[model samples]
Structure formats: structure tokens, C-alpha cells
Target: MAEIIGVIEQLWRYPVKSTGGERLDSVEVDERGLAGDRLYAVRDGSGRFGSGKNTRRFRRMDGLLRLSSRLGHRLDGPELFDPLGRPVADPDAFLRAYLQRPDVALAREDAVSHLDQLPVSVLTTATLDWVRRAAPSAVVDERRFRPNILLRTPPDTPPFVEDGWFGREARGSARSGARLTFVRASERCAMTTVAQPGLPHAPEILKAIAQAHDGRLDALAEIAMPGRLGVGDTLSLV
Candidate 1:
């Protein structure tokens, strides 16, 4: 039996890839990750998706990082927020103006919507705390890492413990039937080092991970058993 590790500390959903996401007190977790997570993305003129990972195709990947989005509870599509935190009624118009590239348009996620390695990404506060030691001044917002679930480990847990979570089976609420099979360690990328709204430029973040943790910060997981998840749900590392 896996020990009762921790309860989820934070939940996040990225309506658009590479763009900032919305924080939630609770969320319905599904096999495809979170509901409406990475559901929308900005496509460039060539019909290629915009992502910080694919800078060659979308040279303005970092540009997309400036904006943020949340689900439109009352609207059919996502509600966008500009750099200054002002609501943008028109995302395409905002993208065109913000990116200064009229050729770009917002595209919803399909088969190609998965820009990352796994469906769900998991991280622990202990790991983040461990990472903070590398550069104390830089902002270490969980948003920068873009994880689906942020589990709060025990107060006594050591930092970077999530690295050991790899290749493990994590069980959640029995009603929700959630069990995540940790596939592999999520390697840090350039996106983590970028300076965004609340985060200052911290290039050393990646260097710290590479040097201190072998460039691994989180774990990518696949749903072994589908179930609902919410804040405060106890997760067992089986």
C-alpha cells in the first residue's frame, strides 16, 4: 500500500497553450488531464501551433507568454486577459495586436493539441522549495512550470522528492477512482526560465535543475484509473 502522501494544493488549467493559465480552488480531473486544459492555442500563419517548445515555427512563442486566459463561464469560448490583466473580448484581435502578427489565430485543441509529453503533470511543493534555493531572487510561481496538479507534501518531506515519484502509481479518492501512473520525469525546458508577468527573468533556474537535479523537476503521468479530483483530495503513492 502506498502511503498517504499529500493533498492537492493547487489546480490549474491552460485554456491556451504557452499562455498563462487560471488558478482554481477545485477542478474535475479527467483522463485527458483537467477539463478544458490546453483546449485552445494560437496558430501562426502557416497553420502551425504556437508553443514555446516550437520556436522555429512560431517565433513569437515568448510573445504568447505575455497574455493569460481563463474559461468563460458565461461564454462559449475562453475569456482572454491582456498583459495588463485587462479582459479581452477578442482573443484573435488581441493576438494580432499583441503579437503584431495578423497571421496568427486561436485554434482549439485537437489531436495535435498536446504540446507536452504527458496528459497530466504533477509537482510537489517540496520539489519547488528545493528549486528555490538555486536562485532566491527569481519568482518561482507554479505557473511558470505549468503543472496540472500541485500536491503539497508533508511539512517534513524533503525537497525534490517528486523525482522519486517517477514510475510510481498514485491513488486518489476511491469515488473518483483516480490513479496516476508516473511515466517519466518531466525535464525542464527553456520556458521555465523565461520571465513572465509575476516572475522575473531567471535563466539560472534551468541551470540549477540541470546541475542539482539532472534537469528533472516534475513527473508526467497517465491516468491509470479515471476519477474526479479536487482540492484537498488525499493522494496515496502506491
Candidate 2:
């Protein structure tokens, strides 16, 4: 039996890693997850990718959250843009100038994975609402989390509902026919506190998650069946 969980509230794709994303009504998904999500990333001389925090595979880079990237109409590749909405002629040069690191350049994801974790990230409206209530001062926008799919749970549903969805399978109730398997609880990160357009630098959001949820929120999933996903699609667990 499949139990209805919620409606698909929004769909997002981050064409470039560590930068802003664009909302879409529909998107194609496959084993690699969203078609153009994170196809490109800022690579440093050390081969580390740009990220909010430093790690073995990533280098902490500032001002990435303020920029945005989107796939071209033909889905060829991501086109980079600056905070002023100007199209970057040379992404590498722009990055070098913006970050003041001449060695850092824009490059496509090769053997290394650009994503922080799983291929797909899932978030719920209830969780966002709970974060808002828990951290009254912080801005709890979905952009902070950068989920590929945002499920809109029922109004009465409690927060952290996705915590129990691990190991379960879900399918969309629409013609696109996308299916997913919840793999694990997505751990919260410092990226959630990064400032973006219309969102201020708010560390309270992550602090609340650490205190209340042990630094984890939402679910990280993988595509069980490749297909299309659209807004307003009903998501149900099988």
C-alpha cells in the first residue's frame, strides 16, 4: 500500500555547484539525479571544489551563495552569472577576480562528485515551518537548504516527518512517474547559514537544528526510477 505524504511544492536545480539555483515547474531525473544539477563547480588549484565549509574534496569559498547559474535552453551546460545579473563571458576569470584566487577556475564535475552527499535531496514544508517556529529570528527559506524536491506535507503534520522515511520508497502521482528511495537523514551544514538574495546571514537556523535535531534535517534520497517531476505532483510512500 502506498501512503500519500504530501504535494510537490517546488522543484529546484543547481546547475552550478555551491551557487544559487533556479526554480522550475518540471525537470527530468535519472540515475545521476536531476538532469543538470551541479554539472559544473568552482575548482581550485588543489583540485578541491568550492563549498561553504572546507573539507578534503572541497575548499571553503565565500560569496558563492550570492551568485546564480542556470542551464541553457538546450540543456547543453550551465551559464554562470554574477550578483548583478550580468552573464559571465569567462567564468574562470570572473571567479578568479571575484574570489581573488587566480588559481581557482570553473570546471565541470569529472570523476569527483559535485554534490555534498546523495544524488537527490528532499525537504518538507513542515520542517521549514518548524524551523521558523523554533528560530524566530532566522529566515527559514527553502533556498537555504537547496533541496531538489520540496514536499509540502499536510498542515497538521509535525516537523521532522522525513526522519522516519529512511529505507522507504516513494513515487510521484503524476505522468512523469518519478520514484525515489529515502537513503538517510541529511545532515545540516554551515551552508544553511550563508547569505543569499533576500536571505540574510543567519547562523541561528543551523544552531537551532543542531540543538533540536542533532544537526540533521530532511531526507537524502536516490532515484529508484528515472522520470520527470513537476510541481503539484503528489508524493506517496510505497
Candidate 3:
């Protein structure tokens, strides 16, 4: 007997890999996961994926976070936005200016979703509250974790419930037939520490995740049954 664990509070789609995402009130999910998530990515002149992290010489990782990507009504169309949330005419120029890197360009990879991990990343407010208890000082915004689904768990539900959801299936609300299978706990990296829009530079956030949360903060999932998912949708273990 699967139980109603929580309601979906938010839905996020990242049109570009690792850039700011567009939050949605509702979305249609398919085998490829969210329709327009991570369909585009920054590629250097040589075609190497431009990503944050100084460790990867070919990737311009951090500055991309400063830009935000939104999907137009057409699932394939993505509009770039500046740090101030204004649509940019010359997105490439805006990116170059923000990143301070030349020869960088946005490229679309139709074959690949350009996802960092699995297709769906899920987390709960309960677990977030636990992190708040652990960190005490840092802001624990869900955006920092970049979860596609943000759930509001029932009171008394323990933190880290997602850790135990591995290999299990979860159904979305709205009677939409959506389903997802928990894959693995999402691992922490330098991206969590980098400053993004509305968030300041604070590497301590990662420290909190590592020291108290075992360096894992979210659960990655694969689509089980694709359907429309909306905010306030119930997510029940199935």
C-alpha cells in the first residue's frame, strides 16, 4: 500500500545545462524527463562543453550560473536572460561579458539532454529543514540543490526520506499517470558553492552538506510513467 508522502511544491526546468532554470507551475514529463530541461549547453569554440570548475581547463563552469534560461511556449525554443532577469538580445555576447571568456557559445545537443546526473532530481522540504538544523546560519534554498521536483512532506516525515527511496517508484499527482524511480543520492560538487542569482558566494553550504549529510543532498530519478505534473500534485510511493 503506497502512501501519500507529500505534495509537489515546485517544478523546475533547466533549458541550458548548469544555468539558472525556469520554474514552472506545471509540466509534461516524458521518457526523456522534463520536456525542455537541459537541452542546451555552452560549448567553447572547440566544441568542448563549457562548464564551471577551474579543474576542467576546457569548461567555463561558474559564470554560466549567472545567466538564466527560459523555455518559450514552444518546447524547443529557449530564451536567454541576464542576471537581472531581462531577456538578452545577444545571448552569446551577454554570456561572454558575464563569463569574461572568449570563444564561448551556446550549442544545442538534440541527442543528449546535457543532464549532469540522471533525468529527474527530487528532494523534500523535510530534508531541507534538516539541513537548516545542521547549518543553522546559511540559507537553504532548494535552488542551490537544483532539484527538478521540490516536495512538501507531511509533518513528522523524517529527513533524508529520499535516501531510502532508491529502487522504488513514485507516482505524481493530478491523476496524470506520471511516475519516477529513485536512482541514487545526488553527489555534491563545486557548483553548489558557486554564487548564482539571488544567492551569495558561500562555500560553507557545501561543507554543511558534506559534514552532516554525507556529501549527498538530492535523489536522481528516471521517468517511469510520463504525464503532466503540476504544483500541489501529490507524490505517493508506488
Which candidate number maximizes TM-score?
2
* lDDT digits (tens) for residues 177-236 of candidate 3: 899988999888878777887887767878878887779987899999899899989988
Candidate 2: tens digits of C-alpha lDDT, residues 1-238: 8899999899999998999998889888999998889988999999999988898999999999999998855466778889877889888888999999989987888899998899998899999999999889987899999999999998889999998899999998769788999999778888899888889999999999999999998899999999989899998999
Residue 22 in candidate 2, Cα distance off native in Å: 0.7
Q: Where does candidate 2 have its weakest 10-residue lDDT segment?
A: 72-81
Error at 191, model 1, angstroms = 1.1
List runs of model 1 lying over 4 Å from the truth.
55-60, 72-75
TM-score of each: 0.92, 0.96, 0.93
Best by lDDT: 2
Model 3 clash count equals 4
lDDT tens digits by residue: candidate 1, 1-238: 6698888898888888888888887666677877778888888878677787754444446667778888845225788888888999888988888887889888876666545678888888988887777768677878878998899998979877766778789988676678888888778888888878878778888888899878887878888877778788888988
RMSD of 1: 2.0
The TM-score of predicted model 2 comes to: 0.96
lDDT of 2: 0.90
What total of clashing residue pairs does each candidate reach? 1, 0, 4
After superposing candidate 3, which stretches have Cα over 4 Å from the reference?
54-58
lDDT scores of the candidates, listed in order:
0.80, 0.90, 0.82
Residue 117 Cα positional deviation in candidate 2, in Å, after optimal superposition: 0.5
